[model samples]
Target: MATTGITPSQDDRSVAELVRQFSEQTSHLIRDEMRLAQAEMSRKAKHAGAGMGLFGGAGLLAFFGVGALVTCAIAALSLELEVWAAALIVAGALFLLAGVVAMLGRGQTKQASPKPERTVENVKRDVGELKERHR
Candidate 1:
């Protein structure tokens, strides 16, 4: 007979012992896999959190940039008039823009209906057709 590398002691073990060893190995493998998954997710979460912080920093910088641009506009206008007058003009223009945008947003909101009109109509039509077919 060809030697399949089974030692005498290993070959002497009962079927139940072999099954128990297999179960133990399977449990260990599952535990290792779970640990690996946990590590991978933790690493990914750390990267995502860092990315979000960077995005927030970028947003803050952009806001400051806009503020700087607005100040520059006011300074340019001040070249022709007083500083206070230039500031007031810019403030008024910004307020006017805000009002216009608010009005447009309100109009769009008013146009949006809570009910799904098209879907409701289609369902009603389908029900009516079913009723006609049954009759």
Candidate 2:
């Protein structure tokens, strides 16, 4: 029988050394998992921010567009009605415009996900894998 110095039997390694190796590896694993989670969360946050920005833009555009439309209508009415009456109509139109914008913005906001669903699912999978491995 021949034994090579390059290969050591499990018994050759000290308990303390094994413990240190296990701890080091475990720490590395945890850090890697944390990095994965952070990356996933960053991606999700970007999407959420973009969605919110879209909603804001939609609201702003709708507000201004409707305001302009109302002003045009009021100007058109000014030819036949008193300026004060046209202004009152414009005010009422403004309220209706705001309601329309609110509805549109609500739809845009509804499309946004406040939760990091992918990260949550990944974390759950990691936890389940770790549990199985530990057991």
Candidate 3:
């Protein structure tokens, strides 16, 4: 029979020795699994961070694009009126749109309550039921 010195023959090992070996192997396996999970989460977080940065860059570019389009609008309006008048008209319209949006947003904000009303009510009901059960 050929014996590899790397490991003991299981058949010759006492039960207590085998149990100790099993406990060590299980602990090692759990530690390895934990390390793998940590590595995977780190990799995912890096990818998500990169994705968020790209999204921010995209939003900036889109904002610049909108500025260009607004400039084009002013240029088109200038053909029918003085350049100063065209610019003022566009600026005024933008302010008017902003005002309308702000008013709408204010109305929406007023309707939004800080409390989680439904959840609170449910919890109160649950507590009442629990008290009744105890009695």
Candidate 4:
């Protein structure tokens, strides 16, 4: 059989070429998507790092500020009471502050509940289904 037009072999070649081109284009698209994702992740990571650094700096500042206040209190007490009594008084005050802070934190935690109603219902439904299945 002699074919003058595009034969089966020619059609196959064309289809293979088209598939190859499509594969190459798809590969390029995937690479571009990966690059975009990497860039976005790097940007977000930089932002998170900067935020953490700012929080650490704030914590350091607060620590030093409290130390300075305690030193001032000790000095003020020294002028009125005996040195040991002044130290004891400052220590007692610090303990009281710690106790109050702990109590406030506990109260806040007790008041805070972030339960999801939908999730609870879904869990209950699943449990009921499981119990029915077992029965």
Tell me, by TM-score, which candidate is best: 3
Model 4 Cα lDDT, one tens digit per residue, 8-103 = 776776767899999999999999999999999999999999999999999999999999999889889999998888889999999999999999
Q: Candidate 2 overall Cα lDDT vs. reference?
A: 0.92
TM-score of every model versus the real structure: 0.56, 0.53, 0.72, 0.62
Q: What TM-score does model 2 achieve against the real structure?
A: 0.53
- Give stretches of model 4 more than 4 Å off: 1-31, 111-118, 122-135
Give the Cα-based TM-score of candidate 4 against the true structure: 0.62
Off by over 4 Å in 2: 1-8, 72-80, 92-135
User: Against the unseen true structure, what C-alpha lDDT does each candidate score?
Assistant: 0.97, 0.92, 0.95, 0.93
Candidate 1 lDDT at 17 equals 91
Ordered from best to worst lDDT, the candidate numbers read 1, 3, 4, 2
Residue pairs with clashing backbones, model 1: none
Which window of ten consecutive residues has the lowest lDDT sum in model 2? Answer: 2-11
Q: Who is ahead in TM-score, 1 or 2?
A: 1
| Superposed Cα deviation of residue 80, candidate 4 (Å) | 1.1
